[model samples]
Target: MTILENIRGPRDLKVLDEAELDELAEDIREFLIHAVAGTGGHLGPNLGVVELSIALHRVFDSPADRILWDTGHQSYVHKLLTGRQDFSKLRGKGGLSGYPSREESAHDVIENSHASTVLGWADGLAKAHQVLGRDDHVVAVIGDGALTGGMAWEALNNIAAAEDRPLTIVVNDNERSYAPTIGGLAGHLAALRTTDGYERLLAWGKDVLQHTPVIGQPLYGSLHGAKKGFKDTFAPQGMFEDLGLKYVGPVDGHDIAAVESALRRAKRFHGPVLVHCITEKGRGYRHAEQDEADRFHTVGRMAPRTCEPSEPSIGPSWTSVFGDEIAAIGAERPDVVAITAAMLHTVGLTKFAARFPDRVWDVGIAEQHAAVSAAGLATGGLHPVVAVYATFLNRAFDQLLMDVALHRCGVTFVLDRAGVTGVDGPSHNGMWDMSLLQVVPGLRIAAPRDADQLRAQLREAVEVTDAPTVLRFPKEAVGRPQPALDRVGGMDVLHRSDDAGVLLISVGALAPVCLQAAELLEGRGLGCTVVDPRWVKPVDEQLAPLAAAHRVVAVVEDNSRTGGVGSAVGQALRDAGVDVPLRTFGIPEQFLAHGKRGEVLADIGLTPVEIAGRISAALVRVRTKSREEYGR
Candidate 1:
């Protein structure tokens, strides 16, 4: 059997000989490269962690011992080793989740994939263990880039304050997070990475300390203290040690022996320890290692053949579409500008950056700053479209509500990946944008069902000068275009059957799904009408009449079921005394696991089959109740 297949858990790794382990590491790398190449996962981060993962598995007893992955994308190798070896179906629907999942395995402690969160999780888990009288060690494997987040600093401070506790913080210094690691931590890590001879000195010191006696004991103590100077002079890790956490390494992370040894050493420390590991992102893969900008950090499907078309087929996304159109507008309008929180590439603003080099700002993973900065730019007479992922936009909720919305700034937010994003797992699904943005006073929210509406709505959003406007779209390509049956106060009637027994109210991506559901209902000789309610914030005036005609009004959205577009419509209809049965079909309030977008939608009962099944059942119940009450 292959080394990967034979390995069941961390204990399986602990027994392997060096040659056997080396062979296993190679097998693991090969498996990862092949798997991720097809699926297009976080290839670079996973590649970097292969040896580190092997070593970690050998050193720690997981399930009992907690190992938190900061920006959990790098946990792919960990997943593979922990008996989740369905590599072919890596990010597919019902496959191994793209990030570490608590449900997927006992090894996964945190499902949060966003950068710089594991430190706080580690701190909390460690504290909880202590309170519960559990002796399990807590290790947080954080990337060098993840350290830039403000919360990581706060956690570091708290971890530092708590002394004589066993907390090992593994800084996986790969020098990248979708892009090269930026800020103070990156520079400090680089200093350590560049240090040569320090490895040999470290090895010699360790060997000498083990063989010492009486004067040898005093010598070992002095030498251990002096080694701090050697590391500080080489790597300057005074920042960690000064915080009262023992800092170790600049160790070669690819060397499983080195990593295992370092981890074992860290186990002896009574207080918190920071073990800095140096590994190459995309270590074994040529395509990823050479490629710049996140090294295919997160990928869509492989690009199609040469296209000589006017518009994109599976085209340049709504993001790219927005980027091109807005850049053209910005070229003519001097006051137009843009901002992205370390996601220029993800949100389709790379072309815009190339055109107006000065106007485009790449603020490193700081969404709060991006929101408020756009507000400032708006106030200074510059129109700014803060293009970002809807998931990341949650990071700037307070700033959007307090800084931009309160001031009534004309800042346009182009939130890409707005709803039920697939593959990337729960942290990435843009399901909360509608519910969260609902509280912002006077804020207009627009969700386009297709490319044409997306382009037009984005243009409209840019022109809004009164309060902030948010345009949301999914991570995938533009959805199906529903032809307008009637235009009534921001909502477009897509379809209305003669009987109209059931009204399928569509929200954003759910438009297509709802329309398909309408078709199923139609086949069953049921009256089903579909309306594409384009803007979610300002309730459509036509909903009252639509609800009155239909026996049941079912609102469908690819968002959280709580206080979402469906709930908003239900409330607006309630205001009109259109007390028809309203059923809100949406995602439940929980972190959805990774899968294909369609699978996730279907799993959450938002697909045509699921939606149809639900509507048919609801209609039957509503009709049955009416008959029981009347008896005329």
Candidate 2:
């Protein structure tokens, strides 16, 4: 049996010898490559942290001593060590989650997949430990890229203030988060990784000075006082020491022994300590190492040997459509600049960046900074298109509300993956964007139905020179265009029955499904009229009048049912005194599990059949209620 096979829990790792641990690391890597090849997941980050994770498991007792992972994608190795070897349906429904899950294991503390949050969690845990008089240690494994976020600095400040707090912050310096980490913090980490001359000198000085006569102790104390100055002159890693936290080595993260030694030293330290460990992003795999763009950060199911996708794409992705259109827009509009939160290629800004290099800006993994900076860019007479994943935009809600929306900046937010977004799990789904943005005044939201609509709405969004505009699209491939039968104000009437009883309002990519639902309702003798509201937000003024003519109105969206386009439409109808029996078909207000997009939709009753059934049932109830009230 393999060394990894023996590792049932954290205790099992402690028993392994040096050679066995080395063998176990190799076994784990092979397992990861094979397992992740079959079921796509975060391959590079997990591959890089094999040794560090093993060392962590050996040194710390998890569940009792919380070992928190920032952005939890790196917790694959952690999961392996904790006896989760079943990778058959990884990131799929009823299988292992891609990120850390509290439901899966007692060892997994926090389920938040968002970056730069582990340090804050560690601080809180440490504070709780002190208050409760518990002896448990809090170790936060944060990536070098996550450090760019303002929250990491905030947590660092708090953790540093409490000098008595026992918190070990292990900086996993793979030098990238999604892509190569940006900003001054990444530069500082790069320096620490390459040059350790000053650290060596300090270590030598401490040993020699302390071993001398009575004057030696005093001299060493004096040198320690000026350590920050000396560090500033050479290393510049005194930032941690200045903040009242003990600074450890820039150790080899791949070397299990070295990492274990560094971790042990940090554990011995009574206060907050940071152990900087350097490792490559895709260490074991040659294909991943050769990937220059993002080091194979995330991947679809691919051949393990060549690293090519297993299956061909069905159609052009929504991102590519946006990419091409944005590039075309950049060519014409000189003032149209682009901004991304460390996800240039991911958000379809790669082509735009390539075409207009000087106009594009990658603001690192700081969404808050990206939103505020877009506001500044707008103020400087440039219309900045902030392209980011819908889920990540949650991080910059305050910035979006205050800096952009409050100022009424003409910054256009292009939200990709703005719907269910299955397989990545709960934290990854973009179901809350519509609900969350509903309250933001002076903000107009556009949910494009097809590739043509996405292109048209994007152009329309940039043209808005006053209020902020958001154009959101789903993760799936762009479907075939459904040409409108007629146009009612800004809404596209896709299907109109002779005697319409139900007005089906389709939001974004769900237009096809809504049309199918309308057909099913028509078959059941309920005449239906389906309309695609190209721009969902500011609840199109034309909808109230259209709904008043119908007996029943239903809004179908890929977002959350509680506060999605459905809720906005309901409010609009209520305000206009259009008392038509309205029903909403959308994702329920709960964390959706990982699965295929279709499977997840079906599970949540977002399918066409389910929608039509619900609408049909509601129509029956409405008709019965009318007869009872009127005494007919």
Candidate 3:
């Protein structure tokens, strides 16, 4: 068996010698490249963390010690060391989760992949250990990109204030989050990274000066007192040290011995300590290292030899459609500025950023800042498009509501990966944006069905100068344009039957499914009318009247069943005195397991066959209830 196969648990790592450990790290990297190439995962990040993960497991006893990983995509290496080595179906149904999963092992904590949160979890866990008078250590591994978030700083403030807390913070400085980490923190880390021999100089000074006699002790003391100024000249790590946390080395992260030494020192320290380790992303893979973009931050299933995708492209993705259109729009509208929270390329803002460099801003990993900054940009007479993954917008809901909506800022929030992003699991799924944004007054939300609607609705959203607007699209390839049979106010009538009994409301990407369901219903002798509300929020005014004409109304969306477009339509129908029996079809209120988008949707009864059956059953129930009332 190989070294990686031998590492069934953390205890297995402690038995390995220095050379064997180095060999293990190499084995892990090779295994990751081959395994992830077959199953498509976070290839570069995992490859970069191979040594660090091994070093950490060896240094700290996880489960007991509580080694928490921030934004847990980097925990794949951690998982492998902790006995879960099967990568055959990583991120697939009934397989290892893409992020840390508590269900998978006792070693895994903070299952959610949200960034900059591990520090807070570490703080609380450390406090718990302290309160119980237990001796377990708490080590949080956070990326420099995650450090850009406000929450990490907030946790740092509290952690620093408590000088006796036995907490170790490992700053995994890979210098990138999607792209290179930007802003002041990145510069600070860069300064620290460039100070190559600062630690050696300090050690040399202490040894030489202290060995010289009575004058030597005081002289060394004076040098230590002036060390802050001396350090500022070299590393400039006064920011962390000044906060009262013991700052350790800008060590080589890829060097197992150096990283283990630094970690051991941190483990011995009684107070909160920060160990800064600098490493390169995609450290082993040549194609990944050479690639300028995100260093293959996330990869699809591919051939390991050529580093090419296993399957050919289906068509232009929803993101590409949005990217091309946004860049085109930027050319025509000079006042249109864009903002992304460290995900310019991922959120379809690459072209926009390239075309209008001055107008676009990458606001680090701070989603709250993105929302507020967009509000500021809007207040300055420019329409700002804050594009981000829909799930991430949950972090900035307060800002979007109070800062933008309350002030009536004309900010357009473009949410790519809007609904049911399957593989990355529950935290990555963009299923809650519609439900969350439903309560924001004067906030209009558009759910585009196809490439045409995405382009047209995006234009409409930006043109609304008085209120905040949102345009949400899924992560899948953009489908063919579903031409409208007719229009009912702002809604598009996808299919209308001459003797329609069921009025089906389709939201966003589910328009095609709704149309197919309508066809299935027609074969079952139940005529159906399908409508796509281009803008789902505020529920088109004509919907109540239209619903009144049908026997029953059914609203289908790819979001949560609670408080989504379905709920909004129900409320509109009730207020208009229509009293039409409505059945809402959507994702049930539960954390869906990792699977393909179609598989998850079908499991949740979002498929055409499933939807048609449910609607037909609902009609039967309605008829039975009406007959019983007549008998009464």
Give the clashing residue pairs of candidate 2, or none: none
Q: Is 1 or 2 the stronger prediction by lDDT?
A: 2
lDDT for every model? 0.81, 0.89, 0.89
Residue-wise lDDT of candidate 1 within 373-420, one digit each (tens)? 999999999889898888989989999999999999999998888888
How does each model score on TM-score?
A: 0.84, 0.92, 0.93
lDDT (Cα, tens digit) per residue for candidate 2, span 1-632: 88888788999988889999999989999999989999998999999999999999999999899999998999999999998999999999899999999999999987869989999999999999999999889999999888889899999999999867789999998973222222455445434432346446767988999999889889999878775565555433577777877666567788898788778877866678888888888789999899899888998999999888998888999999999999999999999999998889999998999889999999888999999999999999999999999999999999999999999999999999988889889998998999999999989999998999999999999999898999999898998988999999999989999886889999999998998998898899999999998888898888898999989999999999998889999999999999999899899989998898988999999888999999999999988998999995
Clashes of 2: 0
Clashing pairs in 3: none
Q: C-alpha displacement of 191 in model 2, angstroms? A: 21
Q: For candidate 3, lDDT tens digit of each residue in 1-632?
A: 89888777999999999999889988888999999999898988888888899899999998899989998999899999999999999999899999999899999989889998999999999999999999999999999889999999999999999977889999998973223233455445443432435445766989999999879989998878785776555453688988877776677788887788778877876778898888788889999999789888999999998987898889899999999999999999999999999899998888888888999999899999999999999999999999999999999999999999999999999998888999999999998999999999999999999999999999998899989999999999897889998998988889989875999999999898999999999999999999998999888899888999999999999899998888998889889999889999998899999998988998898999999999999999988999999999
Candidate 1 residue runs with Cα over 4 Å from true position: 132-134, 176-232, 299-316, 496-502, 523-528, 549-551, 609-632
TM-score of predicted model 2? 0.92
